[model samples]
Target: MSAPVVSVDATPVRAIALILIGMACISVNDMLIKLLSGGYPLHQMVFIRSVIGIMAASVFVWLEGGWRILKTERPGLHLIRALLIVSANMIYFAGLSVLPLGLATALFFVAPLFITLLAIPVLGEAVGRHRITALFIGFTGVAVMMLPATDWSDIPRAALLLPVIAAACYAGMQVMTRKLGAKSAASAMAIYIQLAFIVVSCVSYFAVGHGRYAEGLDSESLIFLLRAWVWPAPEDIWKFAVLGAMSAIIGYCLSAAYRLGNAATVASYEYAALPMAIMLGWIVFAERPGWIMLLGTALIAGAGLYVFARERHRAAPGEVPGPAAERPLRRG
Candidate 1:
């Protein structure tokens, strides 16, 4: 059977709002993650966040009519997608544990580049010479951005691999989304992924022992890590609730955005998250990204924008088309 197609039209104001809200929620999620990295084990953080996500999703499923909302014709694909997402989260969090928030996030943006390459095989879409050339330029930019630190010998090389691997897994997850298409509910897919995360986190936590929990940091750092496990304070409960609500809202908005515009267009705009994160880091944490990092961000953003523009031009009517077609793949 042919894959399901979502309609793409002029962007809506509400869609823009949804995208912004989604970006903010995701940014906040990352900040919380950064906060928790020092004390709580990454596995524990994954487990807690997944549990919160599942619980929140479960409520929606129940309110939407119980088991039916969880139904899917593609269980195996769901499993694959979940595995990809879980892996991506683990790798991403691991990278976050060591890397600066903005830097790690910048590297993660490479996932779209990977997704473009994967589409050729996974989606059977042809990528033409020009798009391929653009893709190469993009990767070159990514490589430049990924240049080793001046004190590279001081840092463990292994640490650098984590974000790269995470980006690949995330890209795989996005490609699978297109493959799964409308055959599955986005909420169900998200639910199962969280379930997978819970399972993995439980396994890792038991294997590693809770005693290794970040114990030696100063009080301030200790509080940050503990933030992941601690129940929301009276004042903070509303914040967590807002986070969950925002998650659902963003989920719907992304779904709607995909329906209204090509994935390339939507994905291009996603880079907006980077600037937002950078600003958040500055305003909230008094952190500023370095010039090299900014240059790297520019390269990556430029590459993505180049690909996005090319895809849009090709998709436009009466244009001399390239072999690479912009297909809207389901990406969570």
Candidate 2:
């Protein structure tokens, strides 16, 4: 039998759908990471997922013309991007293990603002009054979300910092990505990230996960970090593999969405992940965000939209959007 031909029209509707699907996949990936974190060392799951991620990335690289096409003159920059990814994922994953998914994701959404701030120092990008105001409003939202009604002693205050720190690291990575711009291919960069994740995961497993124990730590985040290595259940092995596939799927969908549609429009659709995370958290974990947290999320999202709108308005006709304007929220 002959194969059938299939054509995909990259319309606005299709792009939006792709972005939403990518966000949904990312949310599912986060949920799986949270579920696995309870029993396995975070690095172990990351290591396994990276292994699969590398394979998936490899397939894409091959389709794009093999290893030679993945060449980059800027190896050092790639390593830095990888390190940032490792750090951001570690912090965000730790937060996910302990914090409510909605809250953690809401906090992480502040990365766009962080990117605006970092660009001034890292990319030498000019930041005007509007961007500065957005940054201020975004950080205010962070403060609002971080302050619990009862007390800091009631929850692990340190754990709360994880997502904030993750936002910083994630923003740094995005800035680096923007710096590299057309110098590197996105698929090749992704492969490097997966490779870096594997290296870091192995080092972490050997250094801290091999014979470690939580000891007397009562914090969920601490326990998740210091937990010793163990053989994953067979079912979990499958889950991790699925997560690996989802990682690649997310990369492709996000890339396609941005390539097909307006970057600002696609970026807005990325917020779809927040609601998806909230719904998953509620249905799977029976968790709900407080009104304060919800309000904070609104503030953060609004600030992000302001920044996005400003970027779109500033771009000259036919000019490609800057990374800050086009980059979607980093999925943890």
Candidate 3:
């Protein structure tokens, strides 16, 4: 029997649902990184994860018809994207090593705002008064979240800087992804990113010395690594496997969403990951953001949602839109 035909146009509710699932997958990926960090060097963990991802992507390509899908007209753009993504991952993992999950995730929220600013230069997407106001509010939220008025005299300033740098690199990656979208398949982009990460991780790992990897693995760390590697005594192997599967699914959905909608719109929904991450952290790790952090998160989420809603309204027929209409706003 022939496969059933799926609708090309997903309802807004369906798109929102897929997005939420994608966000959950992303949050769980972060949780896994945190778990593995305890037992392995961040570089090694990134390398291993990238290797797994590369293998998974390879299979996907083969089933989809080999090197044809991997072929890209924009190899240079792909390389640039790889570099940005690798750098962003390194910085983000470094930040995660020190900063709490919620805080680190909060800092990473700046990527969307950065993307909004970048759209003008890279994608030539025009920004309007409403988006400008939203951007200001969003940045204010970031400032409040990152530089809160608290006793931070002893904290390493690097903690704050790392995520900011990561966010900037991530924004660049998003812009590049938008540029490449016209010429490449989503699977191709995913393959390039995974391969780039694998190469980067391998280089970083060997340069750092393998002994450091062994040294980093204490009993607790060993247990975490072993669980990840072997799935030993894992009560949640199925859960982790599902998480991995969801990662691939989310990648596809996000690509589709961006293809169908604007990046700024999709990016606005990206902040949805924050509240989910915060709640997960609170429940799983007993972590909680302070009142100020909560307020900042609210601002960020609201601003992003505003952007998303405006984009959606503009995309809908008969809605009076502004500058955003003249240019194509692509996404990662």
The candidate with the higher TM-score, 1 or 2, is 2
Distance from true position, residue 64, model 3, in Å?
3.7
TM-score: which candidate is best? 2
- lDDT tens digits by residue: candidate 3, 1-332: 11122333545555556556667667777776665565456555656565556666666667656768776666787798778877887778766665667777777776666777888888787888988898899788877766644623334656666777787787777666656543455455567777777687677655653444345453432233232222223654444454345445545556544444444445456667787778877776776677767777777667766766677666665442333222122112
Query: What CA RMSD would you report for each candidate?
Result: 5.0, 4.5, 6.0
- Against the true structure, candidate 1 reaches a TM-score of 0.79
Ten contiguous residues minimizing lDDT sum, candidate 1: 322-331
Which residue pairs of candidate 1 clash? none
Task: Name the better of 1 and 3 by lDDT.
Answer: 1
For candidate 1, write residues 1-332 as lDDT tens digits: 11234445455555456556667667777777666565555666666666677777776557545667676777777788778777776677676666666767777777767877888888787877866776777667667656775523344556666777888887777777666653444455456766887898788766654544445644333333333344444655554555445445545446555555555556566777788878877776666777767877787667767777877776665342222223222223
TM-score of each predicted structure versus truth: 0.79, 0.89, 0.76
Give me the overall lDDT of model 2.
Answer: 0.79
Q: Which regions of candidate 1 are displaced past 4 Å?
A: 1-7, 62-66, 150-155, 180-182, 211-253, 316-332
- Give candidate 3's whole-model lDDT: 0.61
Residue runs of model 2 more than 4 Å from their true location after superposition? 1-14, 150-153, 180-182
The 10 consecutive residues of candidate 2 with the worst lDDT sum are 1-10
Q: What value does the lDDT take at residue 271 in candidate 1?
A: 72
